[model samples]
Target: MRDYPNDQNLQDLQERYHLFAHMDAAIIDAERDKACPEGPLQDLVVGLKANIASIGANWSAGLRHRIAITAQSDAHLTKRLRDHGARILPGLNMDAAALGGGTDNPDLGRTANPHAPDHSAGGSSGGSAAAVATGLCDVAIGTDTLGSIRIPASYCGVFGLKPTFGLIGRSGIVPLAPSLDTVGILTARAGDVWPVLQALAGPDGGDTDSQPAPAQWANQTATPDAQGLRIGIPQQVSTVECTPETLVALASARTTLEQAGAHVETIDMPEWNPAKLRQKAFLMTEAEGAATFAEALGTAGTLPRTVERLLTYGSTLSAAKLVAGMAEIRAARVQLARSFAQVDVLLMPTTPQRAFQADAPAPANQADFTALANAGGVPALAVPIEVAGQALPASVQLVGPAWSEPRLIRLAMVLESAF
Candidate 1:
């Protein structure tokens, strides 16, 4: 096992940035005993979102009262990583109960953007992104339920991948929205994503959501070339109000893909409405979250007021309304599948704006562009785009049909090379 002689420095950074929910030498020591010396992730350090369980560390899922509860066993993905040689760090902080877009936890603390200390790190998975950006860890595991992983990746200028739903096991992850929650990775380098993904993805009996690798994924031997790939930019993207920098970054990415011989065009996907889909997805999250934390909702200090309010609203949703919302989301997924028939990938900005000030009000439209992938249970990769004269990096995402993670990552590499 690799030794962590700089544990003090790690702790100092965690305190400075509020990156971890719990970081102790005892936790690291326990993980070291389980590390594999001959695996793919050997010597790599990884931090996990608070929701993912790791034995000997707290597994509160960012709730204030559950902070004292320790995980009895490693999460399926955590075990896979340890078996593949990754040195697991303590659990990272997150939005309280994973309800908000900003990582301002009323209990633990706010996770500040490493790129700009005054700015916000996008939510739920914000700590995971910040840890990777600040070099606190080589890789971080995050759970994405409606843009959680990609938003933070965009804001923090790191690479984030929300793999095809069920591609990665969710056995030990705390549920927010079972239909939307997906375990994914965030890393400093685009290349690091695949190796870690390879280590953690596969069928898991413990997780009902897990599935066997598709033939295309298992037999994949070479990275796909950008030449002649069909790239589509949805017409709805024009309807969203994006910052000038974000728009420019999207345009530049189009030009880069075009130069690489890819066929880039604007495609009309009338059935796909990002705003409507996001609302539907949020309802599902809140409703499902209420059920997941039913017992805690009765306790006084187990959850924050905002989370309690959201869950209460979800609990009040009529059964018919919930069914209607699920139907609409399913319809949206069908529309997305049909669109994929015409294009290999869909390109769009990860978020409409760059990272806002930590103290600023969180934008309601943060997930407008990102919820489509989650609703459709597809793979989406977010990569930072460097825009000249801009203080923060703008980001673009590539979304594809289910099990298309390999293509998305290869395309991201091509896009990464351009900037």
Candidate 2:
């Protein structure tokens, strides 16, 4: 059987793409040695976001200076990928500490968009998304608290899936917002998303949020659940300010799905405003982030400005405000679920627009659409669809209720065909 070191395709991809932060020969070879050729993911090259720890690899999550830290042991996700026959390529660049949406890292260098190097690779997992889209690796492991995985997938023109909050284990990954953190997959080829997910979906001993592992991998590529699948487009999403290009892409994709025999309908979800939803997400993220970085709080100047700024703000938030935000989010989640109760899945634009320039500040509403899934603790699938003749990638998100990964994947297959 073809293996990582022996596969001509893998060798070719490595030569053509400069996507890794630390692609050490020894670390990769060591992982390759542990791969099971007989496993489901034979011959696959997997990129690990720098934050996802890997034994013996440089473990800094894109820090300005090299810290003398290495992942003395493989993270749960890392071990799972290798055990399932993937050659783990660790240390890909990310927004320093996975703090923001754009994949611009100072310590590890900014990741170039595979489709447009001059543009941003919607980030935090920017390196992983670029690596897959550029063919550097077959798939990548990325962590998403907000839209980290999906935004980059939309920007890079690939597929990214953020399963339900507690579905995938988050044991060794560096925390951005522990309460919202979710580890997920990014794939070059849509067909492989399920198989890779099959190998990795499960609870970890250490992840406090870990719930019952999913048993629906078979359904990832299977037909929708027992009932007829219903796809919903929220009314609020329609009113959000978005680029004309995104509006066009959303219309095009929706039309295609409807034509493909799926029941597509618009549902009212007044509580789900993109910007307000983001603010609530920010409040929750900051509060948890401040606690996560409590050790670094004492030596604030040493931290990155963005990290420090967010942490500082998070530290000072009035307890009543945080409490109010949490209550509001909880109500929003319940309200969002009621919207889902009418449909088996929900559809929305993954980002407000296609990839932005590297220098352009991210659209304040960039994660507006995608963060709904993260905030609600539901599953979301971001599929890149070709908007006829457009060179830039346009993508849409498919969201489902918590633990509805199977249904979400089923819907993703439809978008995959339409794209």
Error of 2 at 211 (Å): 0.9
**Number of the top-ranking candidate, with lDDT as the measure:** 1
Q: Which stretches of candidate 2 lie over 4 Å from their true place?
A: 1-18, 32-37, 214-227
| C-alpha RMSD for every candidate | 1.7, 2.7
lDDT of each: 0.88, 0.79
Residue 378 accuracy (lDDT) in model 1: 92
**Could you give candidate 1's per-residue lDDT for residues 1-419 as a string of tens digits?**
22442768777887789898767677776665664577878878888999999887899888888888888998999889888878887688799877888889988889999988899999989999999988878999999999999999999999999998898998987889888898999998887788888888888888888887776575553253688899999999988889999999999999999998899999999987888888888999999988988898888666899999999889889999899789879988999989999999999999999999999998989999889999899999999999898779999999999988878888888888888
lDDT, model 1, position 189: 80
For candidate 1, the TM-score is 0.96
Residue 38 shift from truth in candidate 1, angstroms:
0.5
In terms of TM-score, which candidate is strongest?
1
Once model 2 is optimally superposed onto the true structure by TM-score, how far is the C-alpha of residue 237 displaced, in angstroms?
1.3
Residue runs of model 1 more than 4 Å from their true location after superposition: 1-5, 29-35, 219-224
